[model samples]
Target: MIMYLLMGLTAAVVSYGATWGARVVGNRLELHMPIRSRDMHSTPVSRLGGVAIFLGVLVALIVASQSFFVKDIYRHNFSPWGVLAGATLIVLVGVADDLLDIRWWVKLIGQSAAALVVAIWGVRMTIVPWVPEPIFLENEMIRIVLTAGLIVTTMNAFNFIDGLDGLAAGVAIIGGTAFFFTAYWVHRNAVLLDYSDLATLLMAVVVGSCIGFLPHNWFPSKIFMGDSGAMLIGLLFAAAGIVSTGQITSGLYDRANGISTVIPILLPFAVLFLPLLDLGLAVVRRTARGRSPWSADRGHLHHKLLDIGYSHRTAVILMYLWTAVLSFGGLAFAVFPWQPVLAADIFATLLMGLVTAWPYLRRGSDEPVA
Candidate 1:
């Protein structure tokens, strides 16, 4: 536990330090993400914030890898080296894209390269929990493709939703926290006796990095996370999901029978549901309008909240609470006898929604579109 806390602290301090430097370097390089018409921020901001996040997670994992518990996990085949290599590649791609406006195809190629590293590291989703038996997809080629696809999808999902201030980071922190607890639960249960504590430790570093960076990222941001930070975080979030969910060999997980075996796969998606929904909407909306999905717009959920007269901080806070409710509700279902509190969660969120949107609701149903 102490080692874990130290790992988180190391990540936090490193990230905070790196963020400070990233700001100076970004400003010095004149590498600002100019305020596009569709952008929410009114002024240009420095964008290579991923530099800090990358360093944070990199150093944290190195320190964590030194722990005997973590070392044992490595011996059991959960190696951080491969994930780190891939993450570094992705971060570079993101930084280059942020600084140089790399072509989309080139960016795709880079992301795929990172995915290849994941495959080479043998990180694959071998089992998907279902009733009666687990669905096995351990064919090396298939696993690589599937795992790589998931990583890319999740990475893009986050990239797509980096529309509002502190949006992606906050969501990530919520998701990472959920993932950390879930992973810890799995590790303690020792259901598979295969995976190590890598998932939990990775999540700790993730949560720590987000917490560290939030001081600079929230509300009126000092620097945007840019593609660098967003994509780096996306990759880490996906890595934790993959590690926690991919290793189980049997459908009969949770021998004590609280959550089902599929919780590993289900949990991350539950946490990311809002972002994923936003991504899907963006793609569909863009396609319908014959625009590129990569094109920026102000049609995001945050935009709607803002348009409805919610202050930026309030909007962010509302989204944060919404995300928390959903994430925690899912966690409860997976690990606890949550039926008792389930209705309360629903009522509370609904009530909060009513309160937040009451002004718009009272005035009229018609609200201005961004």
Candidate 2:
């Protein structure tokens, strides 16, 4: 735990400095993103923030490699290096798209290629980790495909919700924190291991990067994460989940810890609920209108909140709240008694719903929201 915290702090410090450097370099290179019709920000901003994030992750891994506590991970597996390789590929693809406004299909191909890199390097998901019986994929090809699909889907989902300033990074911070704690807990209690593993270490680094990046990214932003940062964060987020799932074992299935076992299957989706929901709705909404599923539009959930008169910051906060409710609720179930966790989730859900609809409820439908 202490070692993971140190790595996280190291990542945060590096990311903070690198972000400022990235902004300066981006400005010098004239790499700012111009205002889009659907975008809310009025000023052009640097989109090279992904470079800083990748640097942060890379440095953190390097620091980890030097630590005796993390030596076991390096000796036993190639997953960490695979993540770095995949991140490099995706970040380059994203940087190109940010610079050239590349075609959507080309970006998808790049994203798929990045996903395949990690999957082929042994980050593939081989087991479902279900309760009654864990479903194992015997064929290596199927595992690779499944893992790649998950990575691609998550990358797109996160990109879709990156419309609001700080939205994507903020969500990653919250989700990554939830995942880190839960994964670490599982390793300590269920796996009976004292040292941190790949998933928790990755999550720690990811959360740290986001923490470092958020001050620049928050509403009334200084720089946008652009496609590069958004896709990089999404890829790392999904990779951590894939590695975490593979860590589950039958030991978690004990009757006393049934909830903990179930969490391994559900927490990944739970943490990503909002982004995935927005992605699904966007795909369906676009398809129904005879447009490409990936077409840009003002119909996203965040857009709706803006349309309903919530201030930009408020909408982002509401999204953050709901993310916390669902994700932490799942985490609580695994770590605490179910009855209390259930009560807390219900209360939090209702509070979030009320906060979301309060504008409409306070002001009659005939009047605009204050």
Candidate 3:
């Protein structure tokens, strides 16, 4: 616990320091990216903010690995090393894209390659908990392909939602917090080893990084995370999800008791449900409009908020609130044994979703085009 707190603080300080450094370097190098939105502030801001957060996380992880709390877990599994390598690759690729406006294909290739590396490190998902009996894919190639696809999809989902200031970071913070508790719960139940403690540490670092950076990122932003930060965050979260859900311990699901292990698997998606849904919606919306799915547009949820006369700060706060509600609610359902609480959580989630969409509801009757 002390290690986790120390790591979190270290990550926060490192991330904050990086942000300061990036600001100086970005201005010196004239690395300002133009904003296309009329709703945005007049001044151009640097997009290399993510470079700082990436560095902070990298350094914090390295230091934490040597700590007593992390040493055993780090030595027992090579997964952390694999994750670090994958994160470095993705961050470098994203930084290149941010600096040079690299081709979309090139970015895609990098993401795919990173995903493949993680999969090659045996990070593939082998079981679907909803199905009776453990369903293992007999074909190794199929498992690798499916796992890589999941990682890529999750990575892009996070990247796609990085449109608004403080949006992706806030959502990530909430998701990371939820993962911490979930991992801790699993560890406490003795279903899994203390390695979940490592997940908690990672979560704390993520939370601290986001919180520290939010001051610079909120509303009229001074810096943007750009692709560098967004892709790195996405990749790390994806890997964490894979680690947490893929390693199901014995007795995790008692089929006769009507308990489902799908809940744990579903936890990641639920924590990140909003962004993933937005990505899906974006693809459909773009395809329907005869544009490439990867094309950027003003049809994002934040854009809709602006169109509906919400302030940037309000929109961001609303997003943060919704993310927290969903992520926590999903986690509560997953870890708690009581059916009543789980049912109540489900009801509350549905209610919150409705409330969140209330802004869109008022502007309705005439369907607003995306």
Local distance difference test, each candidate: 0.78, 0.85, 0.76
Clashing pairs in 2: none
Clashes of each: 0, 0, 0
Model 1 Cα shift for residue 336 (angstroms): 1.6
Tens digits of per-residue lDDT, candidate 1, 229-339, equal 888887777777777676555333364245566576567887888888888898899889999877778888788888988888888888888788777766666556656
Question: Of the candidates numbered 1 and 3, which has the greater TM-score value?
Answer: 1
- Tens-place lDDT digits, model 3, residues 144-210: 7887888888888888888788899989988888877776666665544554354566677777777
TM-score of each candidate structure, all chains considered together:
0.91, 0.95, 0.90
lDDT (tens digit, per residue) of candidate 2 on 1-370? 8989888888888988899998898888889767789989887888888888888888999889889687577876888899889999999999999889998999999999999999998488988777676788999989999999999999999999998988998999998899898877766775455455888888989889888888888878887788888898889989988887776664642422456457777788989999999999999999999999978899999999988789999899988988898888888877777788889889989988888988877677667658
Q: Output the better candidate (1/3) by lDDT.
A: 1
Model 2 stretches astray by more than 4 angstroms = 191-194, 250-256, 365-370
Q: Candidate 1 overall Cα lDDT vs. reference?
A: 0.78
**Which one is best on lDDT?**
2
Q: Which stretches of candidate 3 lie over 4 Å from their true place?
A: 37-39, 191-198, 251-260, 359-370
